[model samples]
Target chain A: MSERGLLIVLSGPSGVGKGTVRKAIFDSEENDFQYSISMTTRKMREGEVEGVDYYFRTKEEFEAMIEAGEMLEYAQYVGNYYGTPLSYVNQTLDKGKDVFLEIEVQGAEQVKEQVPDGVFIFLTPPDLAELKSRIVGRGTDDHEVIEERMRVAREEIEMMALYDYAVVNDEVPLAVKRIKEIIASEHFRVDRVIGNYIKMLKEM
Target chain B: MSERGLLIVLSGPSGVGKGTVRKAIFDSEENDFQYSISMTTRKMREGEVEGVDYYFRTKEEFEAMIEAGEMLEYAQYVGNYYGTPLSYVNQTLDKGKDVFLEIEVQGAEQVKEQVPDGVFIFLTPPDLAELKSRIVGRGTDDHEVIEERMRVAREEIEMMALYDYAVVNDEVPLAVKRIKEIIASEHFRVDRVIGNYIKMLKEM
Candidate 1:
C-alpha cells in the first residue's frame, strides 16, 4: 500500500446534513481517519484545548500564515480568521493517515484546486422538495430569507460537477455507509496501488 | 439511479481462488446479482439443468452464434466450446440487474473490449512467493509444469494494469468484501451517476 493516505473531503449544499453525516462517520467503530482541525484567530472557549478543538493563533499569526499561503482554504467569519492548515493535512497523509474534512462547497472547491487527487464527496439531499421541507421545518428563517437560502442551495448543488461522488443524504447511516465503501474501494484503485505490484514483479 | 445495471467481471491469474471468492459472494445473504451462466457445446452432465448450470448448444449452433459475434468471449477446451453469451448478459443488464462473471484473465480482457464500463476486478495472491507455495503445495504437477504455470501467472498479474481494481485474495471472505465495496462504489462514480443528478437539477 502507498504510504500516502487519502484526503477525503465531504461537502455539500447547505442543510444537507454534512455535519451530521461526518459526525456519524467519526463516531463509527470502524473510523480510522484523522478529522481535520481548523485554525482560527477567534478566542478559544474555556473548555476548548488549543490544537485539539481548534488551532488557536493570534490575528497577526493567522494573517502571516495567510500571506505565506499556508492555509488550504480560509474565510473571514465575524471578523475572525478560520481555515484549514495545509501543512497539517500533508503531514498526516505523509504518515499514512487518512484525513477527513467537512467544509462548505466553496472551501471544498479551494481544496480541490490544491489537492487534485483528494477524494471529494458531495452529500446531497434526496430531492429539492425534501430540501425545501427541511428548511421550512427549521422554523427559524422568514419567508424571504428562506427563499434566498434556497437560491443559494441550488447554486451550491450545481457545483456537484466538481465532486467525485454525490451521495444522497436521505438517511445519515446510509450516506455514511456509502462514504465508507467509497473510501475502502479507493484504496484498491489500480492507479494508486499498481506501482507497488509492478515493482514487486520486477524484483521477482 | 440508472436502470442499466453493472457488469462485474471477477478474474485473476489461474489458482488465485477467483471461483471460491465469487462463490462466497453469491452465497452471502446480501448477494443480489445475477450469476452469468456460460454457454457450452459440451453435453450436459446428469442433474445439470439447461440455462442453470450452462446453456447447452450444438456445435453448429454455437459456431453460428460465434459467427454472428454473439459471444462476449469464448474458448475451445477439451474439444468443446465454452463462452459467455453477450445477448443474455445485455438483456439482464437492461432489466436493471447486475451480472457477475467469474472468468479467466484472457476472457476478461475480451469482455473489457466489449463492455468498457464493466467493473473489472483482478483478484491477486498476497505475494508471488505465496503463489509459488500454493502451486507447490498442490503437489499434482511436475517441476516443469509448475514453472510453466508460474510463468503464466506472472503474465496474468502483469495484466493487472488493465483492471479497475486489484484485490488481494488473501482470504475468500476478505476478497469478497473488497469486491462488494468496489461494486457499490462504482455505482456512485461521478461519471456514472452525475447524469441523473444533472437531469434532476435541470428539472428543478
Candidate 2:
C-alpha cells in the first residue's frame, strides 16, 4: 500500500530557533518533507520572494481569501493579514509529500480543528534563563523589549502542555534530530498503517 | 531539573518479533530504560536466576502476592501463574528510569486499568504472508499448531486500532530503530516534561 503524506504543525515561543530548525529539516536529505508557504498582506522584505518565501498580497486580496474560507487559519499581526492557504496545503499532500507548517499556538489549534490527524509539536528553550539569554543575545532588542518578549514567552510556554510532543532547543543538532525522528515514527501509527491490512484480511 | 521515567506497555501478535525489538531498546546505551521482569509460578528452567529473568514463586506465594495487592496484572497460562509486580515497576520509575513491560494484550489492558499513565505500543508483522512465514520458519511448531497460531494472529491484528502506536516488523533493525525513536519522542511529551515549568511560572 502507498503511504500518505503527513501534516506536521510546529508551534513554539518566539526566539526558540524554530526557523533554524525548519531550515535544517529542509536541508536534510532524509526528511523529504515539504514546507507550507503562507500568504500575507505584509510587504515583502528586501530578500523575500513572492510564492517562494510567501505569497505576497494586498489587504483586499487577503480579505477576499479569508471571506471565501480559502485560508486554513488567518490573523491580523501588527497591521497586516497573515494566513495559510488551504489550496496550497491540499496540493502538497496530494503529491504524497509530508507538509510542515510553522505557525503560532492559535493558528496551530485552528489547523488541528480542521485536520485532527495533524501532528502537533511544540519547541521549547532548555530553561527560562536560557530563553532570556537567547532573546537578549540576538542584539536586536534592548532590555525593555527583551523583558516584554519574556513576558509573552511565559504565556506561550504555558501552552506547551497542549502539544503532542515537546523538543527543547538547548542544542540545535539534537533538537533537529529528535524532531525528524518524531516525524518518521508518526508515519507508522497503527490506525493509518494497519487499516488496509485489516480490510484485505477481512476480504480473504 | 531531573527527568522522570515513563511506564510503557508493549503488546502485539505472536511472531511479530516484539521480543527482539524490546531487547534492542535495552541493549542501546542511549535508552537507559529498564524492563519489568515478571513473576511466575512456573518451574524455573536451567540458567534462570531469581529476580533477574523472573521472580519464580510457588503457586501459594503467587496467590498471597495477589491477595496482598502486590501484583499489577496476572493471569493463568498453561497452568502457571504469571504476573507483573507493582513494587518492582514503581521502584524503577521512582529512580527516574523508563520501564517497559512486554505482556499479552489482555494483560496490557489490565495494566492500563491500574496505571492509566502507561504508554501502549502495538507491534505487527509487515503482512499476513510474512507473519505465516515467520511462524513456520520457527521450526518448533507443527503444521496444526502453526495454523492455530495464524488464526489467533488474525484476531490480534484486528485489535491494532486500539493501540496508541503500531510498528510494523518489516525488518528487525528498522523495527528496533523505530521503537527507540518512539521512546525518545515520548519522553518529550509536554504534559509530563513541561508541567513543572508551567506550574512554576503560574506560582511566580
Candidate 3:
C-alpha cells in the first residue's frame, strides 16, 4: 500500500443517507478511516459533543480562520457558519489515514478547487419519491420547508456529473459496500502508484 | 443496477499474470462478463481451442476484415495477425453484459481510440524480482527472449499513467477484488448513471 491516504469528499442531496452510510462504513472493520469534523458557528444542541459533533466556534473566530486561509471552504447557511478545516485534513492525511468528508455540493465544489484529485462521490436516493418521503419522515420541517428542500435537492443532484462516482442509497449496507469499493480502487489509481512502481523498477 | 454494461480493457506486461487474474474474475459467479476472443492468423498451437482461444483466420481473411473496418485494432506480432473484433464488443455490451478485453498496451491504446470511455486497467507484479522470476519460471523462452521481455515489460509498465486503474498482482484474490471494485465504481460513474437519475427526478 502507498504511504499516502485517500481524501474522499462524499456529497449528495440533503435527504440522501450520507450520515447513515458514513456510520455504516466506520462501524465496519475500517476503524482507521478518519472523519473530518467541520468547524461551525451553530450552537451545540443538546447531547451534542463539542469535538465529535463539530468544533464549535464563534462567528469572529471562524471568520479569522477564513481570513488566514485555514478553512478549505466556509459557507453561511441559515446564519450559521460551517467550514471544512484545512489543518484537520492535512494533519489527518499526514497521520496516514483515509479522511472522509460529508458535505453539501457547494462545499464539495469549493474543496475541489484546493484538492483537484480528491475522490468525489455523490450518494443519491433511489428515486424522487424516496427522497421526498425521507425528508418528510424527518418531521422536523413543515410543508413549505420540505418543498424548498426538494427544489434545492434537484439542483444539487444536477451537479452529480461533477462527481467521480454516484451510488444509489437504496440500502445502507449496499451503499457502504459501494463506497468501500471506491476507496479500494482509488488506491490502485495510476497517479498514486506510478511513482512507487517506477522507483522499484529502477532499483531492480 | 444500470442497464448498460461496462467495457473493461485489462492490460499489463507479459510476465504479469494477466491471464490468471482474468480467468479468476470470470470463474466467479459473475456470469454477465463476456471475454473477447481475438481473431488471429497465427497457426493454432497445441491444446488451443478454436473460438475460445482465438478466432483462427487466414492472412487473407484477417486482411479483408481490416479493409472492411471490422477489426477495431489489428497487430502483427511475431508474424501473427491478431485483432479485436469490434462487432463482438458492441454485441456483448448491447446485450447488457460487461465485455472484458485482455490485450497488450499497444492494442489497448488502439481500442481506447474507438471506445473512449472503456475502463483500462493495468496489472503489474509487485516488484521487478517477482516479475523476472515469473518470466524465468516459464521455460518456453530463452535468456535472450526473457531479457527482451523484461525491457519491454518496463517500457509497457511506464505507460501505467495512461490507464484508469493499476492493480499489483501480489495475490490472486486481492487483484481480482480490486478489479471487481474498479468495475463496480465504473458503473457508478456519473456519465453512466446521471441520465437515469435525471429522468427519475423529472418524472417525480
Candidate 4:
C-alpha cells in the first residue's frame, strides 16, 4: 500500500536561520518535500516571483479567501496578510509528497489545530548570545530593530513548548540533516503506514 | 545549559533486524549513545560477556532488586528474569548521554509506563512476506518455526498502534540512520530545552 505524505510545520525565532535551513533542505537530494507557497498581501520585493515564492494577492482577494474558508491559517502583520492555502497543501499530500510550511509560532499552532496530524518542528539558535550575534551579523537592521526582534524571539522561544520537536541551528548542514531525518521517520509512523497495509490486506 | 540525553526504546517483532539496526547505530561515529545492558537471570549464552552484554544475576538476586525498587521495569519470560535498572539509566542521562534500550514489546510498554518521557521506536520488516523471508534467511529455523514466528509477527504488527514511531527494517543502514535522526531531533524538543531558559529569565 502506498503511504500518504506528512504535513510539516517549521517555526523558529526570527534570527534562528529558518530560511537558510529551508533552502538547505530544498537543495538536499535525499528529500522530495514540497514547500507550501503562502498567499500574502504584502507587495512583492525584487527577485520574488508570484506563485513561486508566494501567491501575492490584493487585500480584497486575501480577505475574500479568508471569508470563503480557503486559508488553513492566516495572520496579519504590519498591514499585510499571509496565510496557507488548504487545497494546495492537501493536493500535495494526496500525491504522496510531504508539504513543508515555514511559519511563525502562532501560525504553526493554528495549522496544528486544523491539521492535528501535522508534524511541528521548532528551530532555535544555540543560545541567546549566538542569536544576537547572528541578528547583528546580517547587518539588515539597526540596534533598536534588533532589540525589538530579540524581545519577540524571547516570547517565541517560550512558545517552543508547543512544538513536537526542536532542532538547534548550531550547524547549518546538521540542522538540515536532522530535519530531513524527522520527515523520513515520521513517514514510517506505524499508525500511518501499517494502517494502510492492514487495509490493503483486508481488501485482498 | 547542557542538554539532557534521550531515553530511546527500540522494539520490534522477532527477526525484524532490530538487533542489526541497533548495531549499525552503535557503529556510527555520529552516535555517542550507550546501549543499556539488561539484568537477567537467564544463563549466559556463548560469547556473552557479563556487564557488557547483560548483567547475569541469580533468580533470587533479580527478585531482590525488584523488591528493592531498583528495577525500572521487569518481566519474566521462558522461566527467566529480565529487567532494567533505574539507577544505571538515570546515571547515563545525568551525564548528558542518550541511552538505547532494545527490548520486546511487552518490556517496551513497561518501560514507557515507568518513564513516560522515554522515546519509543518500533522497527518492522517491509511486509509479512519479507518478514518470513528474513526469518528463514537466518538459515536456522525450520518451516514450522518460521510459520510460528510469522504468526507472532502479525500479533506484533497489531500492537504497532501503541508506538510513537516505526521504521521498516527493509534496509539495515537506512533504518539505523532514521533512528539516529530521531534521537538527534528529539534533543531539540522545546519542552525539554526552552523551559530552563524561560525559568532562568524569570528568576533574574
Candidate 5:
C-alpha cells in the first residue's frame, strides 16, 4: 500500500496574508504538494482564476454541497460561504499526494476536529502592531471595520496555541521557507514512517 | 528569560554513518546549534582533538563524573565509558544555545529517560542489506562478528519507534539536509514558541 499524503492546513487571522503565502508556496519550483481548491460563494476578485484561486459557486450550489456533506470544512464570512471540497482532498491524499489548504481559522478548527492528524500551521504577523498595519493597508475596510479586525486578529493569535506550528509571517519568502521545512521534516516523523520499519522487522 | 535551546540526540545502529552526518551538519554554513562535547574514557586515536573530538579522560575520572551525576547520559562500550557532560549541556542550553548529542543507541536510551524533551533522531541505512554491507566494509570484524553485529543492528532498528524522527542515511548530504530541516522546524513548534504569544496576550 502507498503511504498516505499529508493534509497541510495553513490558517491565521483574517489579514495575515494566508492567501499570499499560499500563492508563493505554490509558485515556488520546489512545490510538490497539490493545492486543494476551495469552493466559495464570494465574488471572484480581479485576476482570480475560476478553478485555480477558488471554485466559485452560487449560494444555492454551495448550500447543496454542505447539505450533501461534500464540504470538508465551511464557514460564513462577510455574507459568503467558503469551504474545501471533501472528495478531492480525500482522493488526493489517498493517492499519496499531499493536499494544501489555506483557510480561515474557524474552518481550520473544524478541519482539526475532523482530521486531527493534519499539519495545522498558524501564520501570524510579526506583532500585533504589524498585524493592524496589514489590516489597515488593505484599503478595503473602514476605520471601525479595521479596528474590529484587529480585535479579532488578537483573539486569533491567542488561538495559535491549538496549532502544531506558529510561523511568523514577517516575510513571505522566509515564511515559505519555514513552511517547506516543516512539511519536509514532518514526513520523517517516527509515527508517520514507522510502519515500513515495523514491516521490515517482521520480514526479518 | 531567553528561550531554552533544544537537546538534539542523533543515534542509530553501528556503521550507520551517524558520525559522518553529524560532521556534515556542523560543517554547514547554516549550523547555529552548539555541539555538546562528550567526556569519554577511551584513548584518543591519531589526529583526534583533545577538547574538540572528545574530552578524553581516565576511567577513574569518568566513573567519578557518573557518580556525581555530572553526565547527562553514559554507557560502557568496548570497555570504555562515553557520555555527555551534564554541566556544559545545561549551561549552553540555559544560554539559549542548542546542544547536539551524537551517541550510541544505548546512550540515547539513557538520555530519553532524563531529557525526554530532547529531539531523538534515529539514523538508519537505506535497508538491512545496505547496513550489513556497511558493517562488512569496516573490515575490522570477521564473518561471525559481522553476523552478530547485524543481529544487534536489527534490534536497534526495532528501537526506531522510540525516536522522534527516522532519517535514512542513503546519502550523507541528504541526511544532513533532513536533520537541519528537523531542527529548524522544531523551533517553530507551538509548544516551544507559544510563551511569547501568551505574554503578548497578557500585555494586550
Candidate 6:
C-alpha cells in the first residue's frame, strides 16, 4: 500500500514540557516531521520569524481567511486572532511528510472535529507536584500566577481522556522515544489498511 | 499512574512468518515478555518440551479444563484438543509482565472476546506471490497441499480487518521492528490511562 502522512496534534497543559519533547523529535533524523506554522494577528515577539515562528497577519487578512473557512481552528485572544491555517498542513501532507500541530487542549478539540483521523496526544508531567515544580521553576511568574497555572493544569488533565495517547514527560528522551513509536505504529493501523488493501487484495 | 501489563495477540496467514517475528521479540533482552504456553492433546513432536512446546495433556484433562472455564479458547482439530489456558496469561499479567499469544485468526477472535483489551496484530505477507513462495520454500508440503494452503491464506487475508494492526512481512527485520514499536506504543494508550488516571487526578 502507498504511504500517507499523519496529522499529529500534540497538546498538554502548561508546563508539561511539550515544546522540549517536540523539539527533540523534530531535531532527530527519523521522520523529519514538519511543524504547522500558525497564523496570528498578535505582534511577533523578540527572535520570532514571520513564517518560521508564525504567519504574522493583519486583522483583516485573518478575518477574510476565517470567513472563507480556510482556518482549521482559530480563536480571539487579547484582541488578536490566533489560528492554524489549513493550507500549509495540506501542502506538507501532499508531499508525504507528517505535520505536528502544537496546540492547546481547546484548539485541539476543534481540529479533531475537522480531521477526525489525526493522532491527538496529551503530554503530562509525572504528577501534580512535578507539574507545580515545573511552573515554579520557570522563575518568572509570581506565586499567584503560578497558582492560577496550577489550577488550569488540573482542569486540563481531566481532558486527557479525549486524546488518543497520553505520553508522560517524566524524562524528555523517553517521552520522545514513545512518541516516535506511536507515529511508526499508527502507519499500520487497520482502518487505513482496510480502506486501501481490501481492493488490492481482491485484484490479487 | 501504576503500570499494568499488556496482552498481545499475534496472528497471520499461514506463510507470513509469525513464528520468526515472535521468536525475535521473545528472545530479546529489552523487555521480559512471557509467551502463553498453550495446552494440546496432540502427541508431542520430537524435540518438543511438555511446557515449552505446549502443556501436553490427555483428552480428559483438556476437557476438564474447558468445563471449568479454565481454557481461554479451545478447539478440536484433527481429533485432538488444543487451547490456550487462561491461568497462565492472567498470572503473567498479574506479575506485571506482557503476555504474547500467537494463534490462528479464529483463536485470536475467541481470545479477543474473552479478553477484549488485547492488542491484536495481523502479520501480512508482502503479497500473495511472496506467500506462495514461502510455503513452497519449506519443501515439506506437496503441490496439492501447497495449493490448498494458498486458498486458506486468501481467506485469512480477508479477515485481517478484524485486527488492530497489520504489518507486512516484506522482510523479517522490518516486520519485527514494526511489531516492537506496536508493543511499545500501546503502553501509552489513552483508554488505559483514563481507567486509572482519572481517579488519581481527582484525588489531587
- Each prediction's Cα lDDT score? 0.85, 0.81, 0.82, 0.81, 0.86, 0.82
lDDT of 3 by residue, A1-204 (tens): 335777999988887888888888889885567999989999999999989989999999999999999998878999999999999899888777889998888898998889988899998777642554555667888789877866866776777878888888888988898899888888888888777656655554
Q: What's the TM-score of each model vs. the native? A: 0.86, 0.84, 0.83, 0.83, 0.85, 0.85
The residue ranges of model 6 lying beyond 4 angstroms of the native Cα positions read A44-49, A128-154, A201-204, B45-48, B128-154, B201-204
Tens digits of per-residue lDDT for model 2, A1-204? 556688898888777888888888788768788899999999899999999989999999989888898999888889998889999888888777899998977898789889888888998867653553455667887779877866876776767767888888888888889899888878777767676566545543
By lDDT, the candidates rank as 5, 1, 3, 6, 4, 2
What DockQ was computed for model 1? Answer: 0.42
Q: Once all C-alphas are superposed, what RMSD does model 4 give against the true structure?
A: 5.5
- Cα lDDT for residue B95, candidate 2: 88
Q: Which candidate number would show the highest TM-score if scored against the true structure?
A: 1
Model 5: lDDT equals 0.86
Residue pairs clashing in model 3 are none
Compared with the true structure, what per-residue lDDT tens digits does model 6 show for residues B147-188?
A: 786676567667786789988888887887898899988988
Q: Candidate 2 on B1-204: residue-level lDDT in tens?
A: 556688988888766777877887777667777889999999999999999999999999999999999999999999999999999899989888999998888788888789887777888767653553555667887788876866876787767766778877788778778888887878877777776565554443
**RMSD to the hidden true structure, all candidates:** 4.7, 5.3, 5.8, 5.5, 5.7, 5.4
Give per-residue CA lDDT, model 5, range B120-155, as digits (tens): 999987764355345566788788987786676668
Model 4: per-residue lDDT, tens digit, B1-204? 666788999998777887888888888887788899999999999999999989999999989999998998888999999989989999999998989998888888888888888888988767653553455668787789877765665676676767877777778887887788777767766677776666544543
Which residues of candidate 5, in runs, are more than 4 Å off? A42-50, A128-154, A200-204, B44-49, B128-154, B200-204
DockQ value for model 4: 0.44
User: Which residue pairs come into collision in candidate 1?
Assistant: none
lDDT of 6 at A88: 86
Top model number, DockQ? 5
On lDDT, the stronger of 1 and 2 is 1
> Which runs of model 2 end up more than 4 angstroms from their true locations?
A43-48, A129-154, A201-204, B129-154, B202-204
Q: Write the per-residue lDDT of candidate 6 for residues A26-102, one digit (tens) a residue.
A: 88777668899889999989999999989999999999999998998888888998999998888888787889988
What order do you get sorting by DockQ, best first?
5, 6, 3, 2, 4, 1
**Given the true complex, what DockQ would model 2 score?**
0.45
Q: DockQ each candidate and list the results.
A: 0.42, 0.45, 0.45, 0.44, 0.47, 0.47
